[model samples]
Target: MFKIKSLVFIFLVFYSTINYAQFTDVINSNRPGQSMAAFSVGKTVIQAELGINRIIEKDKDVDYKAAIWNSDLALRYGVFFEQFELIANLEYQNEKFTAPGVDIHEGALKKVLIGAKYLIYDPEKNYEKKPNLYSWKANHKFNWRQFIPAVGIYGGVNANLAKNKFLRGSDIPRDEDFTLKGMILTQNQFGRYTFLTNIILDKFPSQRNSIDYVLTMTRGFNDRVSGFLEIQGFNNEFYKDHFLRTGAAYLVRQNIQVDASVASNFQASPNIVFAGVGASWRFDANYNEVMLRVPKEEKNDGKSKKEKKDKEKKDKEKKKRKDAVENTEFK
Candidate 1:
């Protein structure tokens, strides 16, 4: 039985010197968390990740409490090449606010983003980490090279539509209809553990100018299950907070996965908590495997042309003599 590992982030097959592997035997998904993976789906493959969350927030300073429900969807397609992916994300939220003798409800599209990610460097490229057949200790020993992670760059445009109350908080400005977002993604996998990190700059050149980071660690328990813990930090002119999330994912099939996670911020002024469930599916019916070919080169052993000719002549004469002997025997 083949176990599906934590395919959350970068896992690549390097062929020749210019290849980064795309796709896998099973679907690779970045879900139950907010970070993106460094590897793209296979060329011509399309994938969808969808989730819904229940969020609760309490603000002592503002003297308000809220309950929110949100649904998010991401569509990813491999385009142009295996190292590149185009993605679109959409989120919708419904909220209810309660205070001293006050009740309010709101609903809107919280997010609309279109992005592209490209893998710039893959540590596993042109390198294979072979297991030591004789020494188990050598196989288990820590290798310093795992510190080198695969790197990717992402850039996107966020469309802040009207009536999106979530994006237009009291502290945030709504002057910008569109903002540019960029992120740096990195991932490392060794043994059963995989580590991923993302550094993001959102709403760039805008008043909010948010800076965010996510760190995640995932471990594979068996062929069908994987668990992950993640931490995210957000900083901007208006607010700052840290959040922790933990979750497990189950592989339902080679092309489908289901996951659930709980998250909470480590703060008091305005505390927040959320729980979510998600699923990812991939369609790869049009994908064709790409392989590298190396041209065969003729070998030269420094044999003289006259020596080759003499050998050929002797072989022909020997064949002739054998034929002559056969003819005489027949006669």
Candidate 2:
């Protein structure tokens, strides 16, 4: 079943790429510019991203180059429920440049995602344990004690707006552009540590189509630490790119978590060498949480007061038992 799904995803991506090729000449010749904004809200996660790219060329200009700028922001919230969970994300970005005294401005509402996930085919089963990459202790392992494969899909739509101008001898025409986009993402996860994949598809106002695939692996190290790695593939007639990112998170307390990651793109654009420190704290409800502490503080204090109290209680009980046994033996 997994193989079938993977093959279908690949085929769809290729099909979309072919369709986009038919418009390559039209898009390239006119120096058409594009900007994208995307937002996703799911049962357990929320994210937003914005990107813009433009090609600058005018009549009788031989030294023409393409200028591009992109920015992305995302947030994830976890919810476990039988019905469905809500997720929200927001993203923003701006891209602009000029050549030969010609000014250009191109931007988009990159992301606005909101959706949910439903539980399906949640079977009760157990399987052997496996090793995880983020395991802190050498001997720690986790078994697939509970098996629940859920099937739910999510999707959203957004708008894109841009403006550009060209100056030439005070007698040139200015260009204005506008676009609308619709996007969808379907995600599925099996067991506690099995195959995870997401299928993303989008349609632009220029009638351009895009399809992407993202695969991820998550491993739990003990109960407080976890690690994940994600690989993404974007296929379109104009460009094809791949990205790989690795990250780890530690539960600093009952309602707080700290995470950091390193990401890189396998393209010539830019190898993103960045590390961020983030934290979350829950006040009333788990979903109503905010980022409070820094990475350093969250990393140092993952255990809560309740957890410490339970440990102390266990220790006292053990000591009392030992004392009672000694007294009986002496008597």
Best by lDDT: 1
Error of 2 at 30 (Å): 40
lDDT of each: 0.76, 0.37
lDDT of 2 by residue, 113-181 (tens): 444433332222122233445766744444343233323454444333322221223332222243232
Per-prediction CA RMSD (Å): 7.7, 16.2
Evaluated at residue 174, the lDDT of candidate 1 is 58
If candidate 2 were superposed on the true structure by all CA atoms, what would the RMSD be? 16.2
lDDT of 1 by residue, 66-96 (tens): 8888888889999998889999988877888
Query: Lowest lDDT 10-mer window, candidate 2?
Result: 1-10
Model 1 poorest ten-residue lDDT run: 1-10
Structural similarity to truth (TM-score) of each candidate: 0.80, 0.45
Q: List candidate 1 stretches off by more than 4 Å.
A: 1-20, 128-141, 162-164, 167-171, 292-331
